[model samples]
Target: MSYHFGRGWSKLTPYLLLLPGLFFYFLISLGPSIATGFFSFTDATGIKGAPIRWIGLDNYREFLFMGRASLDNLDALKRTLIFSFVVTTVQFTLGLIVALIVNQKLKFTNIFRTIYFMPVILGVVIQGLMWSLFLYPLGGPVAKFLALFGMRSEFLGGQPTEAFAWVIFVQIWANL
Candidate 1:
């Protein structure tokens, strides 16, 4: 070993081997995060060759003050919060009940556990896309089922109220 490497070389070798990964992580993670933070202070339209403008706090002010000037905006925000609260409450309640049920000594507990935990195995984006396909317009299961009951309408595309309900439903269903 001593003949193959210079004196003290092995002591530094592990760190040397680690540099590439460290550099790669810095490039992909930290660099992008810092750059994004910086860009948040600037107006970056993301268009090729578009001039970037430095506008500090303007974007934040827009969102934070969006409702104060307009009653419509404030109502929209209230509605959004209500939807969020309902979905979170439903998810928590169902998850707790299912956890308790599965923890009990009963037949088919394994199957029930698997069903409850299956969504947790799926990545968030994959779960969203899977549910979207099953709920989307025209060829979607929801639309076809509705058609059978004399209800004909596009779910994800046409109906905003129904679409929002489905969003909350899927969110709770996937999370629970």
Candidate 2:
């Protein structure tokens, strides 16, 4: 009887320990997801004691099939897809190449790996700040470097096309 009881308790212990984590996961992650889905079908103004009514996909229809909003949304979706593809392809290619180089038997392999991994360890906010300072329009390292070549221009705050290119470059660098 004692052996059987011990075996049963041992089998159940892991699950017992997991219960709190599972509970919190449901509370924090799943609860909000379900609530959002439910609210999507209703006209919830989010005001205190506001009347909530079921609108039955009207919101989605308006955003997807209606006037100017649909065009804007489609444009946003296209940009998002393009960004994702470019980032994913570039990151994968660069990562694989770097990994191959780092995996080889070389004297400075550790130093190279550390240099490559530095950006990964840094937080996004810190990376953004660092890049902004480095690319700042006035007296920045990049601006100074460019000025040495008799060229000066705002980097991040420049024209739309240039700014977008810089954004993509910085994103790839940081992510790599």
Candidate 3:
């Protein structure tokens, strides 16, 4: 009868040990996010310290509602949405294509995989600086390359459409 089932504390011991881990999990992950969500509704900035005024829905209303004070914020929101959607779709398509290619029995499949993932292994700050250098309007490689072909346009600074397209093209090129 004693060995028919485990002792009482034996079963509960594992769960008791797991309690600290669960507490830390909530503290590290969900705690900051919830705090940030609460702060977002308040006009809390470092410079205007001390008193924090709760702005309710003023920020969201101004950005999303009509006849608001700052239409530039609305336009920026639209551009951000469009950019996010386009980047997501394009990156997903590129990933699929890369996966399909890498699934094949190519001679240099491992090498190709390493090359493709190399950028991801690199530091984000370094990558951003590198691209900022490469995409600089006046003296970047892209502008110079276009100039070589007698097709000159400010690849990064000419216009919004041109800048956006160039950014997308560079993203596709470097990522895939």
Candidate RMSDs in Å, in order, are 7.4, 3.9, 5.1
Candidate maximizing lDDT: 2
| Clash count list over all predictions | 0, 0, 0
* Per-model TM values vs. the true structure: 0.54, 0.76, 0.62
Instruction: Give Cα-based local distance difference scores for all models.
Output: 0.82, 0.87, 0.78
Superposed Cα deviation of residue 6, candidate 2 (Å):
6.6
Tens-digit lDDT track of model 2 for 9-37: 68787789899999999999999999999
- Provide the lDDT at 25 for model 1: 98
Tens-digit lDDT track of model 1 for 41-108? 89899999999999998876775576565566667788799888999899899988888998899999
Q: List candidate 3 segments past 4 Å from native.
A: 1-18, 36-56, 66-69, 107-111, 136-141, 154-158, 166-176
Whichever of 1 and 3 has more TM-score, that candidate is 3
Cα-based RMSD of candidate 3: 5.1
lDDT of 1: 0.82
Instruction: Output the worst ten-in-a-row residue range by lDDT, candidate 3.
Output: 1-10
Worst 10 residues of 1 by lDDT: 1-10
